[model samples]
Every structure is written in C-alpha cells, then in structure tokens.
Target chain A: MSKEKKKPILPMIIFGIVSLGSYFVLFNQEGLVTETYTKGGWYAAFPILTAFWFSFVHGSFGSNLLDVVGLQAKKNK
Target chain B: MRKVAAVLIVILMILPMATAVFAGGPPPKNLKKGIFLEVNEAAGTALFQDSTTQETSTLMIGYSVKAEDLKLNKKMMVSFEEHDGQVFIKTAEVMFLDLTLTKFISLIVVGLVGGLLSGFIGSGGAFVLTPAMMSLGVPGAIAVASNMCHKFPKALVGSIKRYKYGQVDIKLGLVMAVSAIAGVQIGIKIQKVVLDAWGNAGSNLYVSVVFVVVLVIVGGYVLRDAFKLSKNPAAADTQSKLSLRLQKINLPPMMHFKTAGVTMSAWITLPIGLATGMLAATIAVGGFIGVPGMIYVCGASAIVASATELVVAFVMGTYGSIQWAVSGLVDIRMTLLILSASLIGVQLGAIGTTYVKDYTIKLVMAATMLVVAVSRGAKIPVYLQDLDWATLSPTTTAVLNGISFWALIAALATAGIIITGAMIKGMREAKQEVQVEESHSKA
Candidate 1:
C-alpha cells in the first residue's frame, strides 16, 4: 500500500488571500501612500514598516505557494 | 565563558561604530522632497510645499528644467542650487509612477531571479536590479533606494533559512558588518569626491571600470578554484594556503568563528569586512568581494562564506535602507512589487543549497560575476563619450546600451538554469540512494 503526501492547500489559500489583499489595498491607495511614505522624518518609518509587513505576509504566502507546487528541500539522510 | 565574553566585547565595540556613522556617509547636497502646488511657467517658478515641514516656498526653475516637465499638484523630488542667495531648482523628478502591467511583470521577474541568486550565492541580483529599474525610467537614486528597501527583507528571509541549516556564523557576520558600515562611510565619501570632480559620466566611468577590474580578477580566481574542486570532489574542503598561513600569525584579539571553523586575528578579519562594505557602497554589490574574501583570505568554505554573507547583507541592508528611507527616496510601490516575487525566489534558492555541493555555489557566483562584468564593461564607451574622452555614434551607443541590458538578463538566466539543474540532479541522486536502502532492507 502506498500513501500520498498532503499538499499545504489550506495555509496556501489563507496566506494567498492576505497577500493579494495587501497588494490590492496598497495599490488602491497609491496617492496617499506616495504622500505618506515619502514624507521623511518620523514618517520615514512608513516604507520600512510596510516592507517588514509584506516580508512576513507575502513571504509566508510564497513559502506555502512553493510547497503547494511540490518544490521543497530534499530530506536529509 | 571566554567565547561569550569575546562576543559581548565585539558587540560593544560595534555599537559606538554604528552610532557614530548611523546617519550614513553624507546627505545629498541641495536635494529636497516636496509636493508642487502650482507652476507659473511664465514666471519660471513654482509653489512647492516641503513634504516634511509643509512649508511653502517659491523655487526658481533652472534653464535645464523645461516648463512642460512641471506637473501641478504632484509629488516631486528636486535638487536646488543657491545662486547669490536665490534658490534655483536644478533638477526635478516625479516621486511615483503609474504601475503598469509591463512594469509590474518586469520588476517581479527581475526580483525573482535576483532573490534566487542571492539565496544561492549570498549576494547578487542588486547589481543588476538597480540598473534594470533605472532602465525602466526610474531615476538612479530612487532605483537604488527602492532596491535597498527590498534587499534587507529578502536577506533576512535568506539568513533565517540558512541558519536553520546550521550554515550561518552570526559572530563572523556581525564582526564583518560592524567594520563594513565604517567602510561604507569612507566609500561614500570617495564616491562624493569623484561625483563632485567628474559629474555623472565620470562617476559612471569610475564605477564601470572598478566593476570590470574587480569582477574579472575575483571571478577568474573563484572559477579556477571551482574547477579544481569539481575535478577532485572527494578532496576535503580546506582553508587556502594564504588563510592557513595567516592563521599562524599571533596577532592580538584572535577571533574564532565556530561555524566557519576558522580562528584568526581581528586584524585579518576586519579588513575583509571593511573592503566588503567599501565595495558595497561603491558598486552596490559588496557580496562579490565579501564572499570571495571569506573563502580565500579568512579561510571559510564557500558554503559558510555564502551563508554568512546573508547575515552581512541583512545588517548592512537594514542600516542602508533606514538611511535611504529617512531621505524619503524609497519608492515603497517598487520595493513591495519586487518583494512580492523575491521573497519566494529567495526561499527556493536557500533550499537549493541543501541539494547541491559547495563547488556548485562557487560556480554560480563565478559565472554571475564574469557575466555581470561584461554587462558593465559594455557601458564604458558611453561613459567615455559623456566625459568627452571618446566619441561614438548614436547608433553604436544604442547598441552598446542594448547589449549591456541583455547581458544582465543573460547572467540571470544562466544562473537560474545552473541552480535548477544542480538541485534537480542532486535530489534525484538522493532519492535513488533512499530507494536502494529501502530495497536492501526489504530483501
């Protein structure tokens, strides 16, 4: 009897929605983003914070996305 | 106990260095970020509101700034010159651009490939990404800022993955980064002097010349080493004779890098880190020198050097990003757009390392360095013409520019193919071994 491995479908879907949603919101508010993000001073934190936020959200999505596609590191012997 | 104390001392030493140069090099002179409220073309001036202070000021237009280029009520980044106490707008650039499909795809593709290269070799992709963004009509400064904004997060991800594999040496990375930061300051000062002396063309010429010379020498040496190791796969990975000899020197403050499996004097290690930082500031690709320096001089294996490089990249990238962001130069749209794909690509590349041998990493790094050297070399003639040192026809200039761009694409494609091929091959062999063992047990 052979057993098939399960795909990370659930996590992929969850992160995919969050990632896409983030992009949608950012692009929709492009004018406000440009103004606030480039303000400099204490406001300079805007771009740095946004980058960290995406790295967590979209970065996780990408990881799950790769697993769903079956691209993963080989098991160590 | 001694090791912990040494590490603490190192951290303490680095803190003051960080605080001293945290502002990073020198700020660009006469540059301002603001929103244009109104433009009076007839009067050759515009009502500009500073983004930070929200203060209103009339900026006199310079002769080079065409009246039609001024768009009312748009965010603009401008450079100014004080002529007899009158502020003249020397150059103006739109801070944000409309996100079109072509640009989005281009950025994602480049980011993915660049992330892959970075994950595999520790540092790369930025050397090409900055120029690629500029080609897509982003200003050089903005392209650099956005590239830096994307770099740290990607490097952070890569470093975390490599750390899980037990390949990262945090101490070595930190020690190097501390001095690298100081090196970046000095490098920037040198760049400013060159820019002030020679203008944009001169700067480009200087950068390209350095790129070609360094890449050729270092890439050639690495490629030769990779070939030697490829021919002798059974041989143990060892420190070079240079590193072995240097390790014998009884200099004070001898440091031990646990993961890299080498102990050397701080005197030896600090210079390598400093050179890495200086080159990073100069050409925006410090990894080319940093990795090779670790492998050849510091006596770390390519794997350790590359993995540790992710740490260096993380530290320097974070520091550099903050400096650029504080200047309000980072285009977050471009940064996020690149991150969307690079985050994925970096993870894949990091995993690829688990499947391949050390020489494979060196092979990819060498190939990339040589190809990128060619790409930069193609731009030398254009810079020469800009400096009035040489003349070239417009057609020739266009062809060279095309070659320069395509050569970068070629470098990325070549690296991607080699990495994928090696990973797949290694995985297949591992699977075969697993099957053989299972069959034997069943029999």
Candidate 2:
C-alpha cells in the first residue's frame, strides 16, 4: 500500500509544474492565442487541440495531486 | 475477465449504429450568414456582404419593405426573396453580437462552480450552465453546443477522480450510456413532432413545462427521502425498497456490476439511460436522471451511482461535443478557461466524497435540484408572455427574470456550501480514522 501510494507522487509533481507553466503561457498570452486561433478554417484546430491537450496534461496533474495528498479510495472493499 | 471485456466491446460497437439509425434527422441549419453595408429602400434592395468571403452583393426585395427595416451598420441575416430576376434580403434580422467581456467572465465562474457541484453530485452543472450562458447572450444553439463541448473533458476528469475513489462502475455506466444515446434519438423525434404541430414557441413551452414538472416531482421525492434518511441516521446506509425490487428482476442476460453490487436485466438498465438521454436532449442535463435511476431503479448505492454518472456524462458529452464541433460552434477558449478551474474543483470534490456517507450525495443533489426547479419555474411566465397567452407588465417581467437569474446563482452557491461543508467534515473524520489506525498498528 505504501509503495502504491508513493508511486504517484513524482509524476504528480512533474505534472503539476507543467500544468501551471502551460496556463501561465495561455492566459497571459491570450491576445496572441485568440487572434491566431479565431482566424477560422484550418486554424480553428488550435482551440480544439488546445482543449484536448489540457484535458490530458491538467487532468493528469489533478489525478496525481489527489494521490500525492494521500486522498485515495479505500482499497480491498 | 476476458468475457466481460468482450461484452463491453460488443455493446460499444452496437451503440453508434443504433444512434445513427434511430437518432432521427440532423439538426436544422438555421444559420443565416450575411453582412450589411447599406439599405436601399428606394429599390427595395440591400447592399450586403457575404459572411464567408466578405464579398459585396446586391439583393432586391421581394416584399414591400422600407430602409428603416434594416438596422444600418449592424450585420444581419436576411431572408432572401427573388423578384423580377433580382435577389433581395426580405427580412433583415441583425446577427446579435451579445457576447460581452462580463459574460465571458461569468461563464468561467459558473463553469468552475458547476464543475465542483458535478464532482460532488455526479451531474448538475449543465442544467444551470446552459441557462447561465443564455443569459450571457449566447444564442441558444451556441450555448448548448459550447456547454456540451465543455462537458466531456470535465466529465472525463471528474470520472477519473471518482473512479480512483472506487465510485465508478465502468461496465454498467457504458451500457447505460449506449441506451441513453438511443433515448436521445427518440426524444429528438418527439420534439420534432411537437415542433411540426405547434411551432417553436409551443416546443419551448413544452420543454419548459417538462423541466418544471419533472424537476418538481422528482426533486420533491428526493428531498423527502433525504429528509427521512437524515431523521433516521442509521437508515442512511440502507438501500431503498425500489432498489431491492429492482435487484430481484433477475431476467435473462442479467449483468453483474461488482462495484455497484447489483445484477439486473439489460431491459431494466436501458430505460433509465433512455430517460436520461431524453432529458439531456431537452434540458442538457442527463445525469440528473441517470444518477437517480441507478440508485432507485438499478439498486446501486449512491457512491457508485454518482461515480458512474461521470462515465455516462463522459460518453454523452463526447458525442454531443463532436456534433457541436462539427458545426464549428465550440468556443475552445471558453471550454479551456472553465476546465482550468473545474479540473481543480473536481479533484477536490471527488476526494471529498471519500470522507462522507452516501446520504451526503443525496443531500447535495436534492438541494440543488429543488433550487434549480425554482429557477426554471420563474421562466414559465416569461415564455407564457412570449406566446401571448399571458401579458405581464414590464416591472413584473423584469422581476421574474431577476428572480430566475438570482435563483440560479443561489442554487450554485447553496450546493457549493453543502459540498464544501461536507467535504471538510469528512476530511476531518478521515484524518481521525487514520490517526487512530496508526496508533493501533504501533501498539
């Protein structure tokens, strides 16, 4: 159980850093991002791709963060 | 295990085929695209620009219309009429640019709170989110589409978090989602029949009535049950008679859900999902029914039911998002902005679940539902006025709209408090348990 618990921590920390870093870029650079993205046609892929990309990265960060905080579901019913 | 996996794959493969066959006709292309440069009333023609290419064009009027009909400098979608070999935009309806910075901020805030509520209660945020978007000046279709796009990823994250906490029943949730998709098709068909008969106002009235009535009835029952359970604290952990009766069906092709701890016929399971999908299509919140159906009809405990809802949400949301994305209506910035906060909120709510009993979910869900019913109830009068069935003074109309908006805000805030309070209490108790257990092990 301890081993299982420890496994998620390192990945969580790494993901956390990356997740926060990406947001810093996206939110701060909203003008450039929005301008480039809303150009229409093929460029529309920017917003869609970005949504999916965050789902994975931010999602992982959240999952690991929970595990690192020792908040896991009870094991073995 | 392999056989179980095989069944899952088979069920998944059949769902899309079923939806395509039964989901009825495609959504109407109500998009009217054009830009106006000038209104020429003398010739009854408007100098307009095509939205796509921005090319200038002249359209002659078919009906007798004045220059004042066109709102100058405002881009409008015009109904075209060809008269005397010349095309004219007959009715120049301005394309409303209702999106404001304030609305954008409101969307993000509502999305975050809704995400938190969803994480705790299984499915709710959309019921409120869609209306919130509408109030923010998003067109009805765009609001629903954008909300759907946000839903899938939010559900994905929420599901994973809850799944980690032993709340999700993957096989069961997937099976229900398939049936729910089929149900959405049926619901859409029914909507078309109503539309054909009574037109748009009638359809809107029908939807509002259904939302008000269903939410009131179901929400009331749930509230009563929650109250009763609270009174008898020991009963909080027990399953209901309806749940037990559902568990005893034992018909052929009975499926076992180990986590939910129930086995029932696919027949029993399919209808719940169908109802969920139908409601989702109407109100954009399928999980409200889906969660309760699992608890009362399928005999799953609240924990599993809520967790599984995230799965259903993920599936439905994904399909719904794809439909919206294809229409090019999804505003990705809005989707991401909401996700940023919601991802964190969902994680917090999911972990919060581990610290409370099943009834806590019930408490939050019932409260949210009842408050939301009030919000929708407030809108009935406005729709009534729209259809000319009833007349309201401006003050009354403003008051009604105000109450409707504030009630929605109240619902969000109420749910937020309940969830937060319960989570904190649960966390404290969980910490105590861990400390006690550690001491015992040391001794």
**Highest TM-score scorer:** 1
Query: Which 10 residues in a row give candidate 2 chain B its minimum summed lDDT?
Result: B19-28
**Candidate achieving the largest lDDT:** 1
Task: Please provide, for model 2 over A1-77, each residue's C-alpha lDDT reduced to its tens digit, 9 standing for 90 to 100.
Answer: 32353458788888878878887787677656644553344654665567677888988987777677766554432
10 residues in a row with least lDDT, candidate 1 chain B: B19-28
Candidate 2 wrong stretches, greater than 4 Å = A1-49, A64-77, B15-28, B33-104, B438-443
| Docking verdict class for candidate 2 | acceptable
**Model 2 Cα displacement at A47 (Å)?**
5.2
The segments of candidate 1 whose C-alpha lies over 4 angstroms from its true place after superposition are: A1-7, B1-27, B82-86
Clashing pairs in 2: B59-B88, B60-B87, B60-B88
**Tens digit per residue, CA lDDT, model 1, B135-173:** 888877788889888999999988888888888988899
Candidate 2 achieves a global lDDT of 0.74
Structural similarity to truth (TM-score) of each candidate: 0.93, 0.84
lDDT scores of the candidates, listed in order:
0.86, 0.74
- On DockQ, the candidate that comes out on top is 1
